[model samples]
Target: MTPRHDENTVFMTEQEAERIRNTVKIRLQRCSELAGHARETRDSKDAIRQATGASLMADMGAADPDSAQTKTQRGTLPVIAVGQPYPPCMLPLRDLQPMKLSNLRMDTHHRGRRLAVKRASPVVTLVARSWTMVFDEEEGGEIERLEVCLHKTRHGQDILESASVFVIKEPYFTLTDQGEATLRIDHPSDLVVCQDETANDILASLNEAKDDVDGVTAAAEKFARACKDHGNAALEKQNLPLAHAKYTEGLKVARQNIVSKSNPDLARDLSRNRAHVNLLLNQLDEAKADAKASLTGRQDQRSRELDSKAYFRAGCAAYNLGAYQEAKAFFEEQRKLTPGNEAASAYLRKIETRLHEQENGAFNFQKIRAGLSRSRPRADAASFVGGTEVRESRLPGRGRGRGLFATRDVAAGEVVLCEKAFCVVWGHEMEALTAMTYDVRDGGIRASPVGLTRSVVQKLLGNPSQVKRVMDLYGDYQGGGNDNVPTKMRPAEEEGPVVVDVFRVHGIVSRNAFGPGGDENGVGSSSSASAGLWVRAAYANHSCVPNAEKEYAGDLLVLRATQPIAAGDEILHAYHDGSSGDYSARRRALMTTWGFECDCALCAAEAADDPAVLKRRKELAEEADAFVGREHWAGAKRVAVARAKRLARDIEGTYDGERYEGLPRLAARTILEWLALAGQRR
Candidate 1:
């Protein structure tokens, strides 16, 4: 008999639930073999429902219907919902090993889990406690509860809710600072939420209208063609991600179907189109592979054009990766396939230029500057670099790592380096200008780390050949391995499936990226911010009184000597507007943002000054700023000019005389400039 209670209440004891389960088993056994199988499934479900209700009531500690204690009880765990059936295209979790949370270790990444939320905390950035189902036996199961947290993902907080099922890919189990066990996911791509649309795709990919080979071939071709058309439309609209996804989905269908051989034409076209998309997306390795795939299969004789486009894509990928010989061969083949191919001809010339630049430091910098003046920047311009080499820093502190040094004595105003930006993202191209909070300590909603990070990852994943160029850059990786960042650049070799941790990429971008500033020399300034990463420039260390200045022209970065420096002197530039702020303020800003304290000569000189003197100087500087900010009273220009001169003198007195002997009094320069302008007006 079912227990009776109020509308929202159900009461039953453990013994009573056990009796109901026995009755269900006995009733199921009495039926015929085929009938018994059907009865067992239904009766077993009914028994579980009753037993679960009793167990939940016990967990809630609800002894009385109207008890005050019931209202004050802890939040109850949500009952597991039977999610939509697993898709036919995917192998069920039962077929593969699902990771047991109980076996997890600290500082390790573990794989496998089909999770159902038991309960979830209010997501700050996506967190939940999920029940991991264990399908150890054919007829029974077990559950292991685990805490999961997704960090720095684009998914909204509400994506994790009660009873939502998910399949965690390469779940990284680790301990938080508070000594709590949690499965932390830093990459958004790591978690695949099992949504209805995703389920439908899996089902649709498997289904066929007719059973014959011709029928299967027709179905596959139709789906692939639709994907290609949709992808082409998206590409035309400049929706790169969507186009890549569409092409990928079409390729997935082709891969799963058995009758793909009967339709090589469809497969060939899909690969070729996807290759073109990959090239645009900066996925060079995938582009090259797809390009090669497009040419391997039987040709579509009905279609008129030669496979010159594939060769072009392959050549472009190789060219960007610094494989000039391979790129030259591919471009030559493309020209042969289609006579009068201007793009191929152009790339061949570029290859020659690149080969010449690599052999020696000679570059046609004049030609590169010509392209920089255009409204839309092109990254195809040849790089010009000489007189500077990356070497270990000779600073007092050994922790300064490496620094750039002049190969020869460099004169003031002489160009030391000019190189194209590895990747650049203009602010106008972003779909939404939503502020992303990576963390509070980093000053929140930074210039444009998100879009730039995505661009960097795509490029790295597509071209493993360029791994050595990037992997050596600094980041905040604390994992057990070498953090995948080599101290020295690794030699160029064939690498398989590079594992890029997005968190590491975020850290690197935060440390080295520059935003648009007022002038070419104003790197890391906040004016009209657009984020770009310049590979060679990242090696230079920071200094308040920098020896070098940076200037940007389109996607190109040119470094010039601000003062004459002998060979072996380390090159440095201001990471921010380090000239305006006082010593303490500058040090504080650097510490908070970059997690480092400045110990340069200028900083050390200012650090030795009397605190009272520094404080007075700061006050006078503020007064001068306030005086010049608004129009003064009639005939008060003389008074303002006098105050500005006095403030500039006070600020100059705060700097150390001996240590800062040759360095410019940068802190006082602004006030002095204002004073000079005021005198001119008088």
Candidate 2:
């Protein structure tokens, strides 16, 4: 029998209320899955309704009149959600097998701060840092600790937390030269955290594990050596990618060792080993840089041998780069360090021959280098935009300026372009710009917006042609092309001739740079987000209803078409979040932020003073809302789907072919939610 509530109020046990909450939560989560699987309105609507009903029951504090009796009769407890409440009495570390703790506080030495505990979100630690520590639990509850380096960082961080206890299944273990064993956590999902009844025991276990710092130095040494061995093994197997991965892992481990100051030899060895791998992989510049790094500070017999190898690698990279003289010099140093080295002798001969050929006018060094440069890897458009073929075109009447156009017919959900930013200035990294300044040689007079502008100027100084390209971008400032910046307070630099290229670059950046979405991962800056300049992507004009959408993956921007675009059609992208506000709100944002009034089809129709079209859209919107308010999910879904289709038709019917494409996409999403609710009703 259903429990009765008083006329004035209802009383319920906390446990019963919790059960009801759990049931509601489960139903809601299930609804999300149903929505994902929903294909048609009828089936989806039924699922959505059940989900809605479950929510209403939970909110109203009503018992599942049938569920309670059925559950009691069946002797089954309510379904528990994953990763909630600590489990009772810690399992033996061996029984747990691989111990994985997501979001657990790992003791780290960062920036001179010893034993600093920082939250290592899966992505932040694994993907960004590429390695973490693992603890081994013994039979008597004692913990054995080892630092593990990861071969890859492609794991997701959505469910990984620092305070959660994770049970690692089927762990892979490797022993270093120092005989310390380290466990690897490769898959993000491999770490499972279950609800615990004795949370204090688990906390104690974790504390014991962290406090057992004996043999940490030896363990770290072993782990770092193991990483290098793994890399070398991968190299021997001719798996360059795996070798690179291992080497990278090893480098991270070596750098993090607290005893690193006492072990300069190991650090030098790690760098040299990675440099050798990079050379074999044809990464000439990286190889050269690494080889140079290995030679910095301290000299011993082991160091000298490593230095010889470094010189050889550097020579080979320089030879590939067509720097014959530099290559010859490095080869000579290698030959001096290791007498009778045939490879170095051979390389020296080759350099001498190349130089002789150049002197004899039989070879064009510049031409050969240019040809080599052409053979180097070209950046793929898919790297930034995904895979869309768009071309820049002038839009005369719109006052919107240059815009991207479709080169061929593009289907909905097609990736149009993937592009890396030409230059990115992260909000937090802006401080770095402040310290970067150019001063007149004699007077030390600093320019206005000194830091950031100076940094940009220095970058431009490195590449004059890039400066020209930046100059071509639109600048809102009304300064003459050759004008020198005028300084009122400066008798400092004779105030006569200060080049304003820094100011010009600043203006161009202000006008065209995009503030990309998402939190910065401390890769570039401490800021939560960054602003970047994508030279080609800058050509895409803004529209309130855009056909193409931009997504940021780190520094890369991906552009995907939301609707089918025919050949020669102008490609449009949204500059702001399109989901918020109505037509007028969108227009205001576009005008204020982008400095343009949108004349897209939706804007035009509203401006045309057509009451019938306006009234119908408003009415359809109201009908959808009314259905939702009444819990009539099926009706709401049907209305939403119809509204989306109608909007699409109106966009297609427009004479100019420009559209407010975001509306239909937003409507489609709403329909999916309604479908989930409707499916629940069934």
Candidate 3:
């Protein structure tokens, strides 16, 4: 009897998978033809039009075995695998690849907007993930087979998902199939899925919700005017939550209605206020989204995508979603958008630390609650990252420069790579300088780590001309608590968009932060205690054995993502990596850059490596962390240096390399120790 192709019979593999290491060879030659033809089409909307862009991605897609199909049915895909494809400990993507063969630098500065690429793991590995085609050698003609299994979720949701299939003629190059079959996720509770049908209404509601931006000042004045008469009235006696709700509603109105083309100040304020209100209500994700929206006014194709706010918002959303990987990605994107945004990157690093704590059973709710008072669970300074102040920088996309672009989907644990403007030296001794010359509201001030000049620090001693600079830093010039406005006029309780040659932020501490100070080769200085305080440290992303390391001397922070960063990968340090080295996510993140499969040695070793190895690695990590937690600076530094040396030696291939050991792990250990000490001092 002949067997049917339905669920009745199991599909058996007739031959071993044909692994192809030379995926790009055939496609590379074809790319020349595709590129020439792509130029003739002249359209950005379609993927097939591009010879290299989507064309290359398509070529690679054709080789995969999974057959992604568009199902018309409302059924959802069942859980193919639990959690992630691989466990956090066994992330196959973290393995670092060889140095970039391309000398291309996507200068996003011309775009004047924030841009990011997929950050790669600094650690190199040997195990490889090869794409292979396994087909039946027998069964006469084309045989149908049943293999995949399914399940039903809580709400009687049956996820009938099927995998996609394609011929594996190459490894990385995907050919356009135009059609295929795969699983579908019917996010039953997704906002985009449900409210999309009424986009107009959704937008209208959003607009109405943002009306406060235009009238908030007037409303505040009215409240102030009526205060004398209504001081003892029922409105004054209203509950905190209720009154808070009213202000919250007004704040929301301001965010949606802000116009980037017209009221840049209003738009920024509204967006900022709404996010703050969200925080008051504990709606962290919503607050973050609003913050991100604030930066779009000055964005263009080439510049960092949005202001720092957008990154903070996206990062918060990813964190709340428990998509730490995604959250890290967003933060990396934020860093790329604003290389000076230390607040965002620091928070990104913090989340990594928090997750590490949790995974190691460090979820001490009581301790967390206690710590909450000292440091909020969310990453940031005393105020909501940045108060309502917004600055506008022209986007670079309008010009003819290669813009910095995101290479892959970034997650929170991942670091986003960025380029730093070279430093301008002041004196002749050639002493490496890490100082910020601020044009503060009230005075002339020079901020640096503890080692900087004392005379430079003493410049603010009773100089009459310096008063304005000093006052501006604290948000006042006329001894009044408003923006750098005129002496007689007041701000009416709401701040306006600043336009003075960068006023109100002469606080050398907030501006001109420290550089990450290193590169992909892991050649650089570790952060000094004080230098870590510079806000610029926020922009210096994490990478194991990073080309740059955020150094702290006293109060300065410096950045560096050194040479050897590939054409597509975002240079990064391990996120709060301490005890053991790069976990599973590290290797896979590197894979995200090439837009293909990864069979890095560490990832390949996951199945066979003793689980105890991972457990022991994490245990040692915790022990190492305990050193920093206890303020054992010497021990922490010792551990950090040892970790770096070991990884460096391992990279040189002198020792028996493990599944995961390299610069990434070492950097993670170093940063975690620094952060621990930093947190304790504060």
lDDT of 3: 0.30
Rank all candidate structures by their lDDT, best first, as comma-separated numbers. 1, 2, 3
Local accuracy of candidate 2 as per-residue lDDT tens digits, 1-682: 1111112112234565455455545544544444323112113244335434644554465543323211222122222111111111112233442222221222211111111122221212211112223222322222222222221221122222333344544433332212222333322323333322232332233335455544554555666677678778888997665676566555554554353664666656777887787777655665776687678534677667778889998898777645678889999998888888999998877676666543432333234333322122112112223223444455545865456776667789876665656655454453222111111112111111222333344344322334454566665443443232222212211211123343356556545666555443222221112456776677788765688898765445667789998877887887775432245556665654455677765566456635564445444544444444554455446555565455444433432224443334332234345556666655
TM-score of 2: 0.35
Candidate 1: regions farther than 4 A off: 1-96, 99-166, 170-184, 192-267, 296-305, 318-329, 345-382, 385-387, 424-455, 458-468, 480-498, 518-530, 627-646, 675-682
In candidate 1, what are the lDDT values of residues 198-317, reduced to their tens digit?
423543645634456566556666776787888899889987766776777677666544636766656677788888887876677778878877775234533324478888888987
642: Cα error in model 1, Å: 5.4
- TM-score, model 3 to reference: 0.20
Worst 10 residues of 1 by lDDT: 80-89
Which has the greatest lDDT?
Answer: 1
Error of 1 at 224 (Å): 6.6
For each candidate, what is the lDDT? 0.56, 0.47, 0.30
Global local distance difference test of model 2: 0.47
TM-score of each: 0.62, 0.35, 0.20
